[model samples]
Target: MIPAPFDYARAGSVEEAISLLGSDPDAKVLAGGHSLLPAMRLRIARPSMLVDIGRIADLSYVREDGDRIAIGALTRHHDVANAEVLQQLCPIVAHAAGQIGDPQVRHMGTIGGSVAHGDPAGDLPSVLLALDAGFVAQGPTGTRTVAATGFFTSLFETALAPDEVLTEIRVPKATAGWSFMKFQRRAQDWAVVGVSAVRANGGVHVGLTNMGLTPLRAVGVEEAVGGGADPASAAARADEGTAPPDDAFGSAEYRRQLVKVLVRRALEEALP
Candidate 1:
């Protein structure tokens, strides 16, 4: 399927990309194009213009910033998975990145693009949510930070304004006690259900994927853990606040049950 005809403009920098997006109210930013291109081909998205920001080299790095690790928005999934700094400080992120799609997709997909797409089935967003990461967005006004908890608002919708471009992702240094579990019927397929659990800040945090309109923190599970509940007891609450989707992959009820099992396994591994 061919995408509807649209104007294209390559941005040399983030500022140029923001300006291009501002030039047209219906303009969409293009990074790796993994998500947007498919939506366009299906005619689900028909932006009048595409502001290509794929060539912005400055926004493709991973580095340490004091007690946090800052990842440039354009950093590829492959790089994020392999970056030594992330491997040492935030291994769950690196592990989750490695589990996304396959090698080709990892090579082409940008962390920023995946996060900005706001897909509920995306593996990284759930990990970021459990870790309580922060996203930095830049627009005409200036830069502002959005917490992962509030960043995702709905299915394929985010708190980012139309003119805002996500520039960086910041995660706290979580050295150990973390696990990411994804359940899929086939290799490189989207997760039917996923769980990310990390022990940080004197407590355990849990995030769920494909269990709601947006990636969601398993608040009930987290609260249970905080109250000194065992892994099985904490995981039993996995379906308390979720609204999993019913589709070809699995039924919502199946996912609700699966999440409980995965959460228990993840908690056991993370809290061991």
Candidate 2:
């Protein structure tokens, strides 16, 4: 398959990338190109221009800031998976990042790309949601922080403005237990149903992947946990508000049952 031809502009900085996006209304920002390139090849994405931000060196770091760990948007998944700070402070995120695709994909893909792509099946978004992470969007108007809960609006859709560039991700240091459980048919494949559970603020926070139009919080499970329900009872509510797609690998009903099981496993691993 051939993609539509597009003009290319390599940005040296985040502001420049945002500027390029502003100048071309239909331009797409290219990071690792893992997400956009595939869509382009399939003719599902047809942008007039591609603003390449992969060369922006400053946007590829993982550091500690105040009570949070800040990860630059360009930080590669491989780096994230091996980051000492993330491993010690946020092992769930590191583990999830490592589980994405394979070694080659992890080496090329970026945390910013995964989060910004807003793919429902992506591993990182659900973990971020469970961690209550925040994203920093930079544009000509300056920067604004978007909460993970609100960042993902729909399938392959995000709250970022057209001219904004996701600059960094901020996650609070995890002082409690956390776990990620993914049910996949094959190695390095997308999860059929994924569950991320994190003990936060003295309560359990759970997020579901490929369970709805967007990576979603297991509101029913969260409420059940808050109300003193056991893991099995809370897990039973895993499908309460989800709308999983009925694909060939599994039907919606199958996904519902899978999520319940995975959530229970995740909760057991996350809770003491």
Candidate 3:
């Protein structure tokens, strides 16, 4: 289907993009155009203008910041998957980034775009949640940081305001013992159920994908593990708080069962 007619403006910097978005209430920011373009083509999104930020070169980088790894918003999945910094410090993130879609999508899709899109089925969000990442956003007022725990609000919803542009993502550098498990119908397809597990501080952090309105932490499973339950026992609670969709992939009950098995496998692999 043809996308609705819209004016296009390229932003030379983050400030310019924010100004363009603020000036036009209906303007959508375009990064890699992986998420927004598809929505626009389907008529699910009708914007009067598209503020392109692809030319903002400063927003495409990966560096170490004190105790965290700073990733710019425009960094592509292909870069993230091969980044030496991410691979050495956070292999789970690199592995998940490499597995998103096929080569074409990974080469064009940006991590910031994936996280900001707030799609429950997106692999990166669940991995970011497990890594306890933080997002930086810039708007007319200035920049602010939002934790992954509160970044996702609902289905296709996020904490970012209308004129806010996500600038960077910050993830801790000390995480280890990580595992990312994805269950899909075919190669390059969205996951039927996915689980991300990583050791943080002293306990395990677990995030579930496609099991709720947003990427969700498996708190019930975490609690069980904290209480000294075995991997199988902790995984039994993987579905305790989720409300998965019943659609073409699988029923809610089927997802519930899948989560248990996947969580168990993930825990067995992630735990020391």
Model 3 regions lying over 4 Å from their true place: none
Quantify all predictions' global Cα lDDT against the true fold: 0.95, 0.93, 0.93
Model 2 is weakest, by summed lDDT over 10 consecutive residues, at: 174-183
Span of ten consecutive residues with least summed lDDT in model 3: 170-179
Candidate 2 residues 130-248, lDDT tens each? Answer: 99999999999899999999999988999999999999999999959988998899999989999999998778999999999999999999899889888999899999889998998
Model 2 TM-score on a 0 to 1 scale: 0.99
lDDT of 3 by residue, 25-46 (tens): 9998899999999999999999
Q: Which of the numbered candidates is closest to the native, going by highest lDDT?
A: 1
Estimate TM-scores for all models.
0.99, 0.99, 0.98
- Prediction 2 global C-alpha lDDT: 0.93
Every model's Cα RMSD, please? 0.6, 0.7, 0.8
User: Backbone clashes per model, in order?
Assistant: 0, 0, 0
**Candidate 1 lDDT, 1-272, residue by residue in tens:** 89999999999999999998989999999999999999999999999999999999999999999999999999999999999999998999998999999998999999999899999999999999998999999999999999999999999999999999999999999977998999999999999999999997677999999999999999998999999999999999999889999999999999999999999999999996
